[model samples]
Target: MPTPIKLSSRNDYESFLEKFDTFLLDCDGVLWHGNTLLPGVREVLALLRQKGKRLIFVTNNSAKSRASYSLKFKKLNIEVNENEIFCSAYIAAYYLKNILKFPKEKKIYVIGESGITEELDLEGIRSCGSSEDDDGKDFDFNDIHPDPTVGAVLCGLDTRINYKKIAKAFNYLYSNPDCLFLLTNDDSTIPYNGTLYPGTGSLVAPLIKSLNRNPDAVMGKPNKPMMDCITNEFQLDVERTCMIGDRLNTDIQFGINGKLKTLLVLTGISKEHDILIKNAPIVPDYYLPSLGDFSELCK
Candidate 1:
């Protein structure tokens, strides 16, 4: 197994950052936690843009669509466009259509939030049930039939998930071993109002755990789909692009998988002591106190 390359000093990190003209950033943890921006994040972004760096905000949170995320960023005073943002919903839709070889018109039962539905519509993938008639009605579990022609189970963040939906997914997955199970991300919970709230990962994880079914694929960070999307959309070489984020499991793993330089900032989930713990698969190429430290490097 390959070990993580560690940069113990600031100079080592600067050397790595100097080579990259394009940056793939994780939004929630790296730039800000919740609604607040990390110190010096704006300045660093501004400086990068001023220096003509190509920056792409890549996120696995499929609860919101790209357009929604773009609007949020603009409200947060970050100058971002829709093209610069790529979410797991978009990636999942693409993977189902092109990678898993699911037909574009294949009808799928999506037990997910609006973002997932929007992405499917964008890709021209048809949903199995409901129109304006079932707008506010709960998802009907009976609608999922155990037909061999049933393409796949596309799981996203469903806030209204219940035992019936989980049972349907489990039954379908059990019956059709070849049927694809595409998950957006595995984040258990998201921080909300100084407390933790169930995220999409939390909702889907139980179904996977109960049925003992690993996903056919996931289309988020640390997975190849998001990385492929970044490369195709940004036209960036993996060697020259850097991924900076605050999570070990997602952001750092994405860099490790993609073979890009990774920077772990302390403003988010993973902390300093977590790095010292040996046998962690998700390790950063460089560690900083925060994004503020990155600003100092730019100076």
Candidate 2:
């Protein structure tokens, strides 16, 4: 019912910050591109902290765990705690362990990175398929087999993804129809070091197509589980929280799904015109060229 507001005026910008005490931010594009921090964005974060606002980093990236994310924050000279960071890998493990009560005896067949493995370990769940599984040899039909003990197949981005990995996942899902199919996120691509690389979704597409089975849960932006992890822990009020990110499909949709206010930043996947299109799937409560723009208000 309400219209989207672009915060270009001084009064609008200040008012936007004042309206919410909690800020949920996306990592890759809104805060930094790859390892490089966006200009003036750090100052904006410091300003938010000075205002005593709650800051949570929500990312679809399942490549790293909380500790890894914290290490990155430390590297960037950004102040963020492990508890304040929420990633799809962490949430997937949490959901399976806490909510689903996944059996301890069974193992999760992981088609992901170290992040998923680490998170599952913290949750006391065993898993198979790590870098060690990449033997680099072509998978033979006679040699391929799925572990009967695999209760779930967890998918995420694998930089070294190859046909062998897909074959293993496909066999696992095909053989064990009851096994839960979970995805860390459906982010089609990730921009890094000035190049767009195929993301987790792209890596998992082959399996999805061959198996003809959709993931039972996608644990990332726009998905309820990721937000639930933070909301349940912090007791945050959706009415007073703001979800900020560059992509409308995930970040903005996550806000809308949770009934929280949304802020769209133009530094990442989506642009100004994307949100203005006719019959747009999602529209944020506010928009800005980048979070860096708010650095002016920090002064």
Candidate 1 lDDT by residue in tens digits, 81-119: 788888998888777777766775456767777777788
- How do the predictions measure up, each by TM-score? 0.84, 0.97
Instruction: Kindly report which residue stretches of model 2 are placed more than 4 angstroms away from their true locations once superposed.
Output: none
Over the full model, what C-alpha lDDT does candidate 1 score relative to the true structure?
A: 0.76
Which residue pairs clash in candidate 2?
none
Write one digit per residue (lDDT tens) for candidate 2, span 269-294.
89888878776668898999989998
Best by lDDT: 2
Clashing pairs in 1: none
TM-score of 2: 0.97
lDDT of model 2, residue 203: 85
* lDDT on C-alpha atoms for all candidate structures: 0.76, 0.89
